[model samples]
Target: MGKAIELNQVDTIYEGEKIPSLKNITLHVDKGEFIAVIGPNGAGKTTLLETIMGLLESKRGEVKVLGKQLNGNGSNIRKLVGYVPQEYSIDDLTPFLVSDVVLMGRYGKIGLLKPITKNDKTVAKKMMEYLGISELSNRPIGKLSGGQAQKVMIARSLAKEPEIILMDEPFSNLDFEARREVSEKLTHLHKTKNMTFVIVIHDIASIPKVCNRVIVMDSGKIVADGKKEDILKPELLEMGYKGIAC
Candidate 1:
């Protein structure tokens, strides 16, 4: 399979910081691969996702997605890659309803000036239903609970009909039952849609069963990358958690 994402000796540094948040990172994700990126806090897991989505430009080296360079074509590339960021600050009085927020995801594909078509609404509705949030379509987004809001974000990402999905701590706000339900839905989507996924999750137990590969990061670098079975070995995990790269 072709690579869906590639980072070659990449170094991403935030402004005003001397040290790069991501250091000498080299990785490749094959199309349709379901991957779990696990690491401790400050391990650069979030940075990796943002860098791949081209939200943060690499200070050195090359970053490519779907065979295109990220430097010159980030906006176009991002439209095909759905991203659910870790946090969003929505004012309680923002006045946007859940349905409106979800439909906003399609604005990139449908064009900002074009009217929303029947097909766009259908896609957005289906995504909300699949995510078990159809009942919240008319609810004000800022009034929803944390878990409810998270589901809306997930639905919005799915509504984009993206070829790849990058999610950061997607289940963090969910309760046990909601987490299980969402995990099952994601697994089904991965199997049926052949969409590539790169999920950064802190809880190893919550990693989806459909995830075939595991990436371990520490100190802004990839310490290990391999099959889930190999990477999840007790000894290996212990080392990885302790900041020792394999």
Candidate 2:
């Protein structure tokens, strides 16, 4: 299997910060792998995703996506990556509808100045239908509830038909039933579309059943990476949480 993502000795430090947010991170993700990155707060999970997506520049070492370096080709590379951030704020009066927001995902492929094609609208509507949010198409994005907004974001990302999807706390706003529903949808997509996913999550129980790998991070470093069955064990997880080398 080809590598979908690679990070070699990567260190990312925020401006004016004394320490790196990510330290000496060396990792590889194979194409079509569903991975769950689990850790407590400040574990650098989000930093790793941003670095992989080329949103944050690394102070040292190399980051690659789809066998290409993320340095100079970030714009082109990002079009193939779909990212759902942990938090997105929307004003109540924001005029864009859910369908419009979802269609925005095609902007990279459609070109910023061009009109939206029929195919683009079809893809957007299909994504909404797949996500079970078709009824929300005409609703104002700003007026949706938190879970609804999150579903819209998921639909938007899916509309891009991206090769890789990176989600940070995607189910944070969802209730138990909704989270399960979304999880099943993601699993189905992973199986049918062969899309790679790296999800940052706080709750281990919420990790999707389709996730085959788990990465544990602490104090800005990856302490363990292995099969889901091995890494999700209580003893191993406790060790990771306690900062013991796994």
Candidate 3:
């Protein structure tokens, strides 16, 4: 498989901060691989995903996505990477419908000033159907539950036709059943769609079930990177998370 993402000694420091959020992190993800980035809070998992998504500027090192550098020439690369944030920050009073939100994903490809076409609407509806959220299409985004909102987010991401999708703590606030359902759907998508996925997750148990490989982070550094069986041992789990047993 071809390399989908590569990071070499990457570092990023937010303004007015003493230490960088990401410190000399080096990693690579191959095409069609499902990698779960596991760590405790403030371990730089989200920073790593944002940096790769071109949402954060790096202070040092190299980040290449789909063979293209992610510094200044990341516009095209960003198009190939779909991002599902941990939480959807929607205005409670905003009147946008679910179908409208899904169609927004195509705005990047459609460009500004041009209205959404009939074909775009058709594609968005199809994506909603694929995600099993077609019934919620006309409902307001703010009215959906966490799990339903998450499904809409997934449909929105899929509408972009991204080859690689990055999810940041996607199952954080969900119930056990919802988390399992979403994970199963994601696993199915990974297999059937040939999509490369890198998800940031705090739960260690979910890693072995959802990801083929797991990368463990601690204090903004990657402490362990290996197959799920190799990295999920008690010793490594203790290194990254406190009061946790494997």
TM-score of each: 0.93, 0.93, 0.89
Model 3, residue 136: what's the lDDT?
95
Go through the candidates in order and give the C-alpha RMSD of each one to the true structure: 4.3, 4.4, 3.8
* Lowest summed lDDT window (length 10), candidate 2: 237-246
lDDT of 2 at 123: 97
Over 1-246, each residue of candidate 3 has an lDDT whose tens digit, in order, gives 789999999998888898999999999999999998988888988889988998888889998998888757467667788888875687777799999989987775666568989988898998888878899988999888877888888778778878899988777766776676677777778889889999888865554265788898889999999987677777556766432121
Clashes of each: 0, 0, 0
Sort by lDDT, best first. 2, 1, 3
Flag regions of model 1 displaced more than 4 Å: 71-73, 235-246
Native-to-model Cα distance after best TM-score fit, residue 192 in candidate 3, in Å: 1.9
For candidate 2, report its TM-score. Answer: 0.93
Please, what is the whole-model Cα lDDT of each candidate in the order they appear? 0.89, 0.90, 0.82
Better of 2 and 3 by TM-score: 2
Model 1 Cα shift for residue 145 (angstroms):
0.4
What local lDDT does model 2 show for residue 102?
Answer: 95
TM-score of 1: 0.93
Residues 29-94, candidate 2: write the lDDT tens digits.
Answer: 999999999988999999999999888999999998999898564776688899888979999999
Backbone clashes, candidate 1? 0
For candidate 3, list the clashing residue pairs, or say none. Answer: none
